[model samples]
Target: MKSKGFTLIELVVVIVILGILAATAVPKFINLQRDARIASLDGFVGALKAANSIVMSKATIVGIKSAKVETNIPNTDLYVLDGHMSIKPEHIKAAMNIEGFMVTNYALTMTRTTFVYLADKELTMPELRALNCFIHLTRSYTQQDGSNVIDTGDLKVNEFYDGC
Candidate 1:
């Protein structure tokens, strides 16, 4: 009699094909998490740049040369650009916009002439954490032509791809 269903050989072949497809697809899905984290970090850097520019423009308009400014937050001080209020870690946390991220640390050194924002704890992946992935925003003030000027050195991202 003619067979009514797939032969054992055919079934085995189909199963093997499926397994191959899964092997390839699984890796793609796994990489998505790493890509997502990288994208988030890039977005944060962009936001920081925009915020800094806005603050600087405002400060220039107001002729303020200091990096200290009064912010909307009561009892808290923030950096200033040109006279405009600049953003700080506290503001970012209060916004609660970024998921799985925190402002890990903030410090001023060199007699309060340098400011640093550290966001490291956001990287939750074991590999990334082991790599010590972090983001840094540093600003230094300098005396130029008898006026204090703010110099944003760079936004740094420390991420090792192997960890991701």
Candidate 2:
């Protein structure tokens, strides 16, 4: 007479296989969040670079000497200054899908010779959210003697967006 289930080795082998599969699959899933964050950061950097190029190019013709970029309060889209431009949040949203994806919280400082932009992004799980962006502007003036001087240090960022 033989009993039905006396196979400890079989159970152990099954458990080992399961563990191996889990070990391999878990890491890939966990890494997805990190990839999303990197993508978001890249997009932001690209947009900032684009805007900087635009400002520098147009300044000479517009007599903009120096200017700061601003946005509507409590939002990322709808830029104001010279004209309005639309910024699509979808790219960011797709990457992070954070709770509050509409607002931007970062700061910017600019001069005819230099411009600085910074963002305080809060990461949740795999998502990133921005707080605010402030900007400052300075102007450069050239003298007939071929001397260049930088003037006007008015660092102002118009009200726009809430910290979500």
Candidate 3:
């Protein structure tokens, strides 16, 4: 009588095919987390740029030389967009209008004049916390024709991709 089951050779061949497929698929899956982190960082950068532009426009309309607009968060000092004052971590959160998300999802650390990101332990890998990722905002004064002019510093992202 002929057997109605797969032969040992046939079973081994099927297993080999599955293994090859898995080997190719696993890399794509592993990269998903990195891609997601990169996207999140990019989104945050876009938000920062948008917020800065809005604040600057408002300041210009109000005839203020500096970013002296009220923030979304109460009891926080006004953000000086003209670079007269260094932006604080709270200022950044308020400017981005993502205080709730930041509070719930990530830890913000202030080092000198830079804001650093640390992923929450419950939601992210410990390696992310050790990565050097930060944003820096600085403002300086320059003398132009014997007059002091405030020069706004651009926002800089450092080691953002390294963490991802």
Root-mean-square deviation per candidate = 6.0, 11.2, 6.2
| Model 1 lDDT-worst window of ten | 110-119
- Tens-digit lDDT string for candidate 2 (1-164): 78798599999999999999999999998677555554544454455445545543444344443333433322232232323221223322322333422333233332232212233443332242243222222333334555544333322333212221
By TM-score, the best candidate is 3
Once all C-alphas are superposed, what RMSD does model 3 give against the true structure?
A: 6.2
**Candidate 3 lDDT, 1-164, residue by residue in tens:** 98999999999999999999999999998799777766766666677677777665555555553443322322334465443223566666655655323322233432224434434432342444456343333333345687545344555555446655
2-114 per-residue lDDT for model 1 (tens digits): 88999999999999999999999999998997777667666766765666565555555555645454334233333453343433566544433555555543343431221
On the 0 to 100 scale, the lDDT of residue 96 in model 3 is 66
Is 1 or 2 the stronger prediction by lDDT? 1
lDDT of 2 at 52: 42
The per-residue C-alpha lDDT of model 1 at residue 26 equals 96
Q: How many residue pairs clash in each candidate?
A: 3, 15, 1
Q: Model 2: what TM-score?
A: 0.36
Instruction: Record all residue pairs in model 1 with backbone atoms less than 3 Å apart, i.e. clashing.
Output: 59-82, 59-83, 60-82
Which scores greater on lDDT, model 2 or model 3? 3
Predicted structure 1, TM vs. truth: 0.59
What TM-score, computed on C-alpha atoms, does each candidate reach? 0.59, 0.36, 0.62
